[model samples]
Target: MIFDYLIYVFLGIGLFFNVLAGVGLLRFPDVYTRLHAGTKCTTFGSIFLIGSVILIGLKLWWEKDTNGSVLALHSALALVAILLTNPVGAHAIARAAHRSGVKPVRAIADHLAESPPLQTGEKTDKKQQPQEEGGK
Candidate 1:
């Protein structure tokens, strides 16, 4: 009885986090922030959700039922799917956002933007001037 109650508690907690993730997605402003919130929170929440399912599956399997074993195996596969895809999806979103120029709010520094200017004509020497070396 106590063990069953514990399983229910895990389930409830998992559901709560998933719900919180949804709320974060709806409430956050701008694309970057929204993506950040959506990706991280949802990933975290999903762990709990899947963990709860896994626990239930484990409990079932412990009871020596055939269906429980199948359920547990499938739940593990689902967890793997979630783990592999979440980070990759988040990376894709972040890359797309960056390429689209959706800058983060109040960003003071841009390291990539500060790269040295590119020379159009040719490669310049370290100690000599380009104008003296190549006459245009």
Candidate 2:
């Protein structure tokens, strides 16, 4: 009785957040903001979605269904993967955007402006070139 209600609650929350994420991706001004919205909302939504499955699996396992254990285990594993990777992937995308000179729209503070790019090739700037040895 209450279990079904709980599942409904989880599903509702998950669907809400996932839909919110879609809106954020479309509505956010810059790559950083969009990535933040997309990653955080989707990650949180996936947790609720997978959590509902875990609950279902536990309910089935209580009824002596072997497949329920597998379902719960697989859902748990997927949850862990999503938790570990989503933020990291978002950060990577944001960094790539920043490195490629994408500026945030209407941003008041630019904290990363002082930080150097994480990876670079040989510098072509004349000032960056070293002086010749022995004035050669």
Candidate 3:
């Protein structure tokens, strides 16, 4: 009885965070915030979702179901993958966006603004801008 209730609680919490992630993606003002919300919320949500699954598998295994071991193992592996990949992927996306000159909407403080630019082979001519696509 208590175990089942624990699963239900985990399910509810997971669902809430996942829904919040979707809302954040749709409603956030800028790329950084959107990515932050999506990655963080989903990671947290997935932890609980998979945790409940693992609990279910353990419950079944306790009842002598062989498949429960497989289920539990797979869920644990997936949870590990999600934990490892989500943040790294989000960071890559944000870094690419920043490098491509995507500025935050109405940002007050930019920490990256002070960081030294990446070193390229050719010197960056600050005074010279890239030619416009339709330049005569």
Candidate 4:
């Protein structure tokens, strides 16, 4: 009784935030803002979604026997997987976007302007060549 109501509540919250994330992705004006909303909102919503499943699994396990235990354990593993992957993937995407030169819109200042790109490459242009050539 109470468990079912809690599961429904979790699902509702998850769905609401997921929708908010979608709206933020579409409505945000800049890459950084969009990324912020997309990552945090989706992660929050996903936690709730997975939490609902976990509750459902626990309910089944409480009510039933061995098979329910498997379901509950697998859901727990899935929740762990989501927790491990989401932030790492979000960091990778943000770094990739920054490295690939996607600047934020209407940004007044950039603190990372002095920071060098993560992966260095060989200087391919003569402008970047060493100033060691003798005068003619």
Q: Please report, in order, the local distance difference test score of every candidate based on alpha carbons.
A: 0.72, 0.85, 0.87, 0.78
The TM-scores of all predictions, comma-separated, are 0.74, 0.82, 0.83, 0.78
Best by TM-score: 3
lDDT of 1 by residue, 7-114 (tens): 777777777777876787898777777777777777777777777777777887888877877887887798788889998998888867774667777877655431
Task: Name the runs in model 2 displaced over 4 angstroms.
Answer: 114-136
Superposition error at 67 for model 2 (Å): 0.5
lDDT of 1 at 106: 81
lDDT of 3 by residue, 35-86 (tens): 9889999999999999999999999999999899899999999999999999
Tens-place lDDT digits, model 2, residues 50-129: 99999999999999999998999999999999999988888888877885778899877768763253213224443432
The full ranking of all candidates by TM-score, starting with the best, is 3, 2, 4, 1
Model 1 RMSD vs true structure: 9.0
TM-score (C-alpha) between model 2 and the true structure: 0.82
TM-score of 1: 0.74
Question: How does candidate 2 score on lDDT?
Answer: 0.85
As for TM-score, the candidate ahead, 1 or 2, is 2
Q: Which whole-number lDDT from 0 to 100 does residue 120 have in model 2? A: 38
